[model samples]
Target: MMRDQAESLRNMVKKNRSVDFQVISITSGKGGVGKTSFTVNLAYILQKMGKNVLILDADLALANVDIVLNEKPKYNLLHLLTGEKNINEIIWSSKYGIKFIPAASGFEELANLPKEQQMFILNSLQDIYYSFDIMLIDTSAGISESVINFCLAADKTVVVTTPDPTAVADSYAICRIISNYNTGNMELGLVVNMTDNEKEAERIYNATNNVIRKFSGKTIKYYGCIRKDEKLSKSIRERFVLTSRYPNSKYSQDLEIVAKAILEGNLPEKKENFWRRILNNWINLKFD
Candidate 1:
């Protein structure tokens, strides 16, 4: 039964090849590093650029994308996984014109869902695979099995970090772990957040890049940085996206540049079926 469903999903992908949706996993090594904020703001900017976007709040436990967006979702991924609802029912459209898949907060079983259930959720996404131009996955922090699997399964992974030494160290650890997997078609990149200036961002990026290259022999593409801005905190308190609240703010402009870089990059054509590749990786995932 599962095999038949998987086959059907593959055909759906092949038929919608022209849509060319890009799936990007945004993650970090430690919590409270502005990872989710970056994800939300980026989606907002992309939508403003006339690109259809969807955010999958992959942080199973403590999921808060909906909270950040100031919108309440009727359903979440847990409902979809448990067969209580379909994918469309769980996806909520934000006022910013972008859509998102909310995850259940404090759900332990969801954090470590069984392999079969994981595939079931991935297979369910086929119905809307071509519905958007970009799918941004906001994965949880740390180098857990779930984090690594989510990063590996995406078309690209953006590792977010700050100028703090501990954050840089943790970012390197996650990058090293992801480097172990032969990411055939996946692009690995880094985003330096909370920098005082461009120079500080470069220093942090170079430091993290040096460690990864020296220890893991993996190259990480630089995706620019976001400087420290006081207005960012104010926007957060107001529960409004920084881009929408202060489009000319430095933080918002910086994210606009990053989004432009991502849009300019050449994503490889889909050589294999999307869901098939994701399920194959999920089934053979290793955590050691």
Candidate 2:
């Protein structure tokens, strides 16, 4: 890890960097809906839109964002937890200039940290959080504490689901959890991935919102759907981003539309800055 370079970033972040950062957690009710893929591609698009974007790989168990991007981070959250790396040291950037922090399965060990180490973490990350216009958290599937905490903390959470019945049910489950837990008017958006057509995706989005309103008394915004393209699976297997490998594919084109909506739609009332909320992990709650 280049301590000098990372240390310089820490110093630079404090020179009047605004805290108006948007923390959006892209999560799903279940796995296999292409949630991480969407997060990675969206980061690419957001950066291309001239926004400083960072993807926080919050998938605790099966983190494949690195695999999807074809870039392996030298240090990760585990290293920071173990005092082997600082918060800035763990961040890795793709060749495409997409920055991300990969979380190892071993980050499960964070629940048992001592006070000194916990404070060390909070102090270290405060400088780095403002370095991005947006921070995209690719949360793990299901209603795990990590997933719920991230969703609850974010200014917005976009739940990605497919038109499948089971996926729709799980999407409702996630919406319910966030609705019950969130204290503010945190925006919730829906994206139907892998659909064959927009009509099917819209139908699924409406059905999912109907269930949310009936049970949770809240509704989610409909971000446009991303249809599955033939090149999607091929790019994944080849460890290349769909946007870079096949920019003309259906998936990339659909993502650009969603990215536009996300930019226009996600202006939630700001609360505590995201890093402060993360600091709460060791102070008030434990994600593990």
Candidate 3:
């Protein structure tokens, strides 16, 4: 029976290849760097451009994508893991035309789910893998087991960092960790958040990229930056995404440019499905 089920999943993934879905993991080395906010706004912009988007809140222990959008989710990843609900049941659609899978905040079990449970979640995702043009995973800050696993599974990993020394150092740490496991296939990019101007953004990117190149010999692409804006903080307090609440704001414009850069990447051909690759990575994951 297990063999049959596995074969069925493989066939389903092979047959459903009409749409190409790009899986981008947006992560920060340290917490409170606006990774989640950037993810929500990027999803909104992508959806506005007529591409179906899904935001998977992979933070597990501190999911807040729902809070940013002001939507209450009836189910989360815990429900799927416990067999209380299917993956579809946990997905909530927003008015902005993007769908999201909310995570269980402060749940230790989910934070350290075993390999079998992780495979189950990936299997569930296989059912709806072809339903969107892009799936952005907003991972938790720092280098945890979950963070590394998700970053390895993604087609591209976008490291979000601020101009702070600690944030920049941690961001490079993340790149180094990822480079060790990336095998030269995963595309790595950087986004400088809360910058004063373009020069500051470029300086931060250059400094971080230099360290990464020196240590790992891998290149990190510049995905643009988010300028420091008071309206961004106000939008957060109001529980609304910046793109929707203040479209004409400077922060929103910066996000739009960043989103354009993100979309510029060539979408991987659908010869091999993303879910299959994620499942393979999860199965082969080794913890220290």
Given candidate 1, what's the lDDT at residue 240?
Answer: 84
Task: Give me the runs in candidate 2 sitting further than 4 Å from their true place.
Answer: 1-17, 105-123, 268-271, 276-288
Model 3 has an lDDT value of 0.83
lDDT of 3 by residue, 35-148 (tens): 999999999888878888889998786789998888888999999988999998999987766699999877887777766676577778877867887899999899987788
What lDDT score goes with residue 257 in model 2?
97
Taking all chains together, the TM-score of candidate 1 against the true structure is 0.91
User: Candidate 2, clashing residue pairs?
Assistant: none
The C-alpha stretches of model 1 lying farther than 4 A from their native spots are 1-19, 286-288
Candidate 1, residues 219-240, lDDT tens digits: the string is 7888999999998788677778
For this target, which candidate reaches the highest lDDT against the unseen true structure?
Answer: 3
Measured on C-alpha atoms, candidate 2 has an lDDT of 0.78
Candidates in descending lDDT order? 3, 1, 2
User: Candidate 1 vs. truth: CA RMSD?
Assistant: 2.6
CA lDDT scores, all candidates in order: 0.82, 0.78, 0.83
Better of 1 and 2 by TM-score: 1
